[model samples]
Target: MIRFENVTKVYDPNARPALDAVNLEIDRGEFTFLVGASGSGKSTFLRLILKEDRATSGSVYVAGQNVANISSWRVPKLRRGIGVVFQDFRLLPQKNVFANVAFAMQVIGKSRSIIRETVPEVLKTVGLEGKERRMPHELSGGEQQRVAIARAVVNRPGILLADEPTGNLDPITSMGIMGVLDKINQNGTTVVMATHDDDIVNEMRKRVVELRNGVVVRDEARALYTSMIPVVGESRRMKDASDAEIDRAQGVQQ
Candidate 1:
């Protein structure tokens, strides 16, 4: 569902690259986690896929569209179908829960006919149906995040990108959000989540991609994060740079 080939992202000419030649692929209906530290290029990698920032060189393709080289005219169309939830939970302060989720469809120019039929269904899916009339401040942190997730999945996009999604919540609330994501993944939307929550990562036991200093140190199928990392271990250091660089290089542009 997503592919990155030879992708590199250098923030400034002199600054170290945010994502150095990142190459990876995520399959449809898979729940994958990107585990990395604050400056480890996980956010940069997510932004590359979102086209919020372009790779300095290489290609990023989503749903087979070459995003690295995507035409300017079609960028909006590409994003309209994909759902993104950031660590901050970008919600409209004035909009209530239902309107917040419904607003996504409205902004995309989806018809009132469609909105009327879809909004409540998605709200129900995210377990926010009764709270639809309440304002953002009226909801708890977890509920507000669920509202964000409802908005994201309302359009039924095939891929979901979440960055630090459960960052602020307690463990139970965080797991609640994870459950929503897992449900969405099970229903066939692809999920690529980037997080630093070690407990959650260990408990989920999903595909794990570990990045350090903008390089992929580990990409293991059904992987477990054995240690707190980019600090993997001496054995990881012995792996060939070419093998590590191989992932960096697979992004659409690197």
Candidate 2:
């Protein structure tokens, strides 16, 4: 439900573009991972989709409309169809879990009765069912992140964008968060996550789109974090074998 055509984003005339001729398409109900080092244009790619930043050149289409063609006043409406989760878990400290999630619907002018019904259901989906009355500080890091995820999806957005979602949690906790995300994906939300955690990417074996210096170097289905192929079009069987070997080595180390 997202497409980018020769997209390039430049912040300064003297500096290099944050994204350089990047082309990508993410279909509905697909779970994809955007893996790269710092400054590899992952965040920039997301911002373009959200229209938080305008593309310096080319087009970005989300949910059938070109983001660049959307009027400024309509941006909010566009975002309502998309959910976003961040690494920091940006929960409201003063609000309890239920209120935090309900606020998302409230801001969109949803009735209190609807908010009351929806918030609890979403919290349950994120595994925070009984913790609704607790405030942000009262929850653990993973729980707080779950609250964030609940808030993001309360409106049933068509696409979910998670940027470094598990970056702050332990590996086990991160896996739990991934499980929550996977469930949401299965329920028909298209998921695009940007992450640097190799173990998580390798273990999940999802579609991976690797970026290097703002350019997409690899896009593979059921792929590992690291590519065994020195070149893009190498044998898939060889890559799978190499990934298996890497997993074994990691297991031995553990």
Candidate 3:
């Protein structure tokens, strides 16, 4: 679970705040989408949760503890309960698939036997069972991203944060990645993803939080990419036709 109370983040005194007076909460086992244009504070919101960037004002709580109150020495421990995936698959080029996943556990002082047992299972979960020996360059774009997802969740983090996770892949591939993420959420890992793909958001119909100019404009459950407004005559018919097309696209992917 995560909560932000009247949070504001300012990088420079002369510039506007990246986030301003934003209060939001994400409950355990819920999947939420942070939707906005560029520079709309989506990434800043995530960094505050991770304590990668300190809030200029107000409080951020993760799992009931104020992230700002946590000591610098304990930040690593806090991050161990959260998993992060990025738009760019940040796989270690020199390390094969198995080692890349195992490294997360190893850095936390997990035993070799544990790493050996856990890495393969996670890789298989992400649909990479037979590719354990492959290098990052040898995998396709989607497969590389799957490897990144596997590495992030190998430790079974309580929360998963994905920032533009499907930005680099084709629609079909993005759907596949979303399927993997959905499976993780079903098992009770809270998922918060930031994305700009309208089709994906509209298809998933999850809780959507829209931000603009560092302010929360809309937060709705089972929402589409944007608010729909009433239209008249031919325009209404056109809108209905467009929605039908989107539904067809998603059906084909499924």
Query: Would you list the rank order by lDDT, best first?
Result: 2, 3, 1
- Please say which candidate is ahead in TM-score: 1 or 3: 3
* TM accuracy, model 1: 0.89
Kindly list the per-residue Cα lDDT of model 3 for residues 1-254, writing each as its tens digit.
99999999999879889999999999999999999878879999999999999999999999999999899999998999999999998999999999999999999999999999999999888899999999999999999999999989999999999999999999999999999999999989999999999999999999999877677777889999986544557545644665586689789999
Residue pairs with backbone atoms closer than 3 Å in model 2 (clashes): none
Listed in order, each prediction's TM-score against the native is 0.89, 0.91, 0.89
When summed lDDT is taken over every stretch of 10 residues in candidate 1, the lowest stretch is: 226-235
lDDT of each: 0.86, 0.92, 0.92
Backbone clashes counted, model 3: 0
Q: Which stretches of candidate 1 lie over 4 Å from their true place?
A: 227-235, 238-254
* Candidate topping TM-score: 2
Model 1: residue 108 alpha-carbon error in angstroms: 1.4
Ranking by TM-score: 2, 3, 1
lDDT of the structure predicted as candidate 1: 0.86
Q: Cα miss at 38, model 3 (Å)?
A: 0.4
- Lowest summed lDDT over 10 consecutive residues: which window, candidate 2? 232-241
Which consecutive 10 residues in model 3 have the weakest lDDT in total?
229-238
